[model samples]
Target: MLASRNRDTNSLLKSEKKSLLRFLALYTSLVILLITLLSIFYYQSQEKLMFSNQRAELSKYAYIQTKRLKVLHYFFPERTTYPRDPRFKSAIYDIEYKKIFSLLENENIHFNEEIYRAGNYIHFVKLLDTYYLGTKYLIIEVPEDMAWKKEAWKQIAIGSVLAFILFMVFGLILARLFLKPMRDSIVLLDRFIKDTTHELNTPLSAILTNIEMMDTDVMAEKNKKKLNRINIAAKTVSQLYKDLTYLTLKQEQKDHKEEIELQGLIRDRIEYFTALANTKQLYFELDTENVIIHADKQKITRVIDNLLSNAIKYNKRGGTISIKLRIGSLEVSDTGVGIDEEKIPFIFDRYMRFNQSEGGFGVGLSIVKKILDEYHIKIEVYSTINKGTKMVLTW
Candidate 1:
């Protein structure tokens, strides 16, 4: 069932891809969230430090002006001139919150220690003693320039991009690390199957060849029956070996496609399994036309052999198998303990056996399906429990 194996491999790969994407997406989201929060914190801290330094500079200027005013009040008591600084706009207010003198036209200001931003200026307010030329509040306004904030944001953006790249690289590494064990186990299992199949080939061929060469005519009737039983058993093992070899070494097999007479091939395969069928007293009704098909002979033989083998193996004692071959189709119907409707869909799956009591690896239908797929053949199955199964293959 190369097709089935390929499908399984593709399905597994898709599942792994989804898992990798999910892990990467979740990890990227978390990293982005952490980076965003840290950037916000760094930006706030930088802004706070910048404002604090500006406020200190403004407070120094206010102190200088206050000292100058006290000196001017003692020297020229009647003059309206007050000490001023050219670095920033300044204002003086009375105890009733009324402005006395200001370089700015607007007098709206609050008496608080913290800095405030209004319009395009950084505002700072402080309380003054009435002894400093009767001024009760001093306010300072500095022009606000956001160049430092823009630079800080640019740095944060660059840092976030670098962090995302680093996390993606590490996430891929982590995903590979997590999948390593599973890959190793699959490789180990594949090696075991290949080795086991290789080992089984020689002994199986030897047994089947020797049994075929045996002289059953010279033996007593009872002994002949025993020999027949041995032949049947050997053939059963031989079929299993063939299925295993096909699954393991299918890629190595060479295809030689040629026109084949379907009638003769079906008859030959049926004869091959005659001994096995006789074990259960099964009979066959062949209604085959002399149809010709262009396909690999060995693969077509395998398809027919597996189907006949399953029909015989699952058939009741003295059950009749009806085989029909027409222009572009082949039908095999058997009086067997049939498969359930639900299980019919999975009948072609490797190692899927509905009847566990039957002695088989459950790969017969899977092999048949693969061979048919190569020829672009379609198969339909119909069955009723405790009744029979009818398999129809149409080109």
Candidate 2:
């Protein structure tokens, strides 16, 4: 029964995993989008502020140049033709030559001109100061007239990359953190299933054995028949209990890949269940090959027992239970009430009952499946209702 639950749990987990991953991907994408938008906004704001400051400084310089021209045009009349102070010593279109001569002439005035030149610089002007007492013309340079906005672009690139990296780091860590509790819950559930199955084995065995020891013959004939059917019911529970234990602990038994005679194994298990078959008046049909299987003996025994007992329980009165152990296959064919086509695959699932009168927990074939899986074996079942059923196990 837990085996079926495990399969169902696995399916649920698989579905949940897909949803979690899709959600994580979507959240990560959203983080990236928000970060990109913020980076763009930050860079735009900084660009606007930087350009605004540049424009303010340029406007102040233009106003100073216009005022200086007005002063020079009014106060200096002999210099209306542009006075040549000894301070203005270079030829008319040479600011470099003028500054060089002025520096050699007077260190104090040259220092003041150099300070102003460093701030609102006009490179190709003719005078010591573009704001000098001039002949009524002014020269102005704006930082915006440059060919490239290199610094603004550099800041934008750096900010965008940093935002992208920051979001990636946070997204990965958050996704893992969010999924941790779910992973732990799944692990706890698996352990609980395994533990519960283990606890059931001892009591179920005692119940089956005590029922077998009951004195049914001394009772009314009808009561005797009812007791016998109860015994069958008990055995079916015992079968399911055994299968659950097998699926849980059978793996660590170190009982894989053994060379054993197939005929002897079949005979041994048949003899063990001979009493049960006798109660149901089912005849045994055995076909042997002296073959050897490299597999666990106990697990194979469980598979045989489940199949044989099922055939006996579901068979008609005095039905034939045929078992064949061939070279590459082991087949069990029963002259019992067969199965519907739709129920064949479902039989391997837990607690799936097609016939309520079968008196089983419906875990036998699931155990058969588990054992066969360990040995890399495959099984096929074909049946028609009330006719017969044949099961083939291929290795």
Candidate 3:
């Protein structure tokens, strides 16, 4: 039971982790997308502000060059020095947008915009009131300033990283809060099942013990049949009780593996379920070898018992159950209502009921699967609807 509890707890923990991961993945992806957009917006706004702030300085340089050009234009070709400044490079274009003379590094200029960036320079176009020396357009060029961009990117990266960390912490808290109700419900149910299974042990043992001790001899034939019916019913409940107990509390019980003869174990389980099988007129066809394997006996018994129980429970009247055991494998085949191909995949899922016609909690195969997995055994299912089903376990 200790082991079973651990497996259950681990399974639940795995489920919780998966849910949290899915939530975080989606949440973080959206957060990243939003941050990217905001970063782009923030950078663009900063670029516009930088352009605005630098405009006055550039305009002052343009004024100085224009004044110089006017003075040189007044003196004709003799006094032509064409204004030059150490603070900025200048370009002149005629009314046709053709360059007259240029000191700017990049000759390609956008005349339509008053200010724009081209290559590694910022060009500011200024219209002169006087076309001094036939210069209608005055353009100023300066080396591109990317200091603001660098700082903006740095801040954006830091802010984005910090935002992600904070959101992740909040997301974790939300995930746990979302799962609290579900976890509490499961805990309540688990406690109830554990308590119920514990309460059932004493009564189930007494009933089985008294039935086994009963002597049907010298009784009326009708009375003997009634007693037999009682015994079968009691045993059915006993098996269910055992299954519940196995799932609920076996934690303290240490797993003890011993050399077990497969043939004898198979026979024993068959005999144990013989009364239940007889009720449906189902018979077993045993083709077992004297194969010996070392495994936990109780766990192995549960596996065999579940396979046989399912075969008998789902079989048609007088149906044949074939049990074949080999050196490293066991196969249980039944001429019963076979499972649907799609349903077969989920047959071992806990509390999964495919056929509502059958009366069961649907944990039998689930228990069988857990035990098989613990021993690293592989189970395969072959089924055809309305034909039959076969379960093979290969270690």
Best candidate, TM-score: 3
For model 2, name the residue pairs that clash.
none
Residue 275 CA displacement from its true place in model 3, Å: 5.2
Each model's RMSD to truth, in Å? 9.6, 14.4, 4.7
Model number with the top lDDT: 3
On lDDT, the stronger of 1 and 2 is 1
Q: What is the C-alpha lDDT profile of model 1 across 1-395, one tens digit per residue? A: 77546634632463357567888889888888888898999899988987898889878877877777778778875766876667888887888877788885345575755577767677777677755766888887878778878889998989888988988898899987887676566545545656787888888888888887988879899998887788888888888878777766663467889999999999999998998898899999999899999989888888898888889988999999999999999999999999989999888876578689987767678778878988899999999988999999999
- Of candidates 2 and 1, the better by TM-score: 1
Candidate 3 per-residue C-alpha lDDT over 39-86 given as tens digits, one digit per residue, 9 for 90 to 100: 888889988988897788889888998988898898978896777888
* Candidate 1 error regions (>4 Å): 1-190
lDDT of 1 at 49: 83
TM-scores of the candidates in the order shown: 0.56, 0.46, 0.74
> What is the C-alpha lDDT profile of model 2 across 1-395, one tens digit per residue?
68556654653465357657787789877877786787678767865665566556545554554464556657766455432333122112233333211211222232223122223322112233453542222233432333224665676678778877787777767766887676666556546656767777787778778876887767899988777677766665666667656655664467666787889988987886776787778899888789887777778788888888778778888889888888999999888888889888778765456478866556677677867887789999889898888989998
| Residue 265 shift from truth in candidate 3, angstroms | 3.3
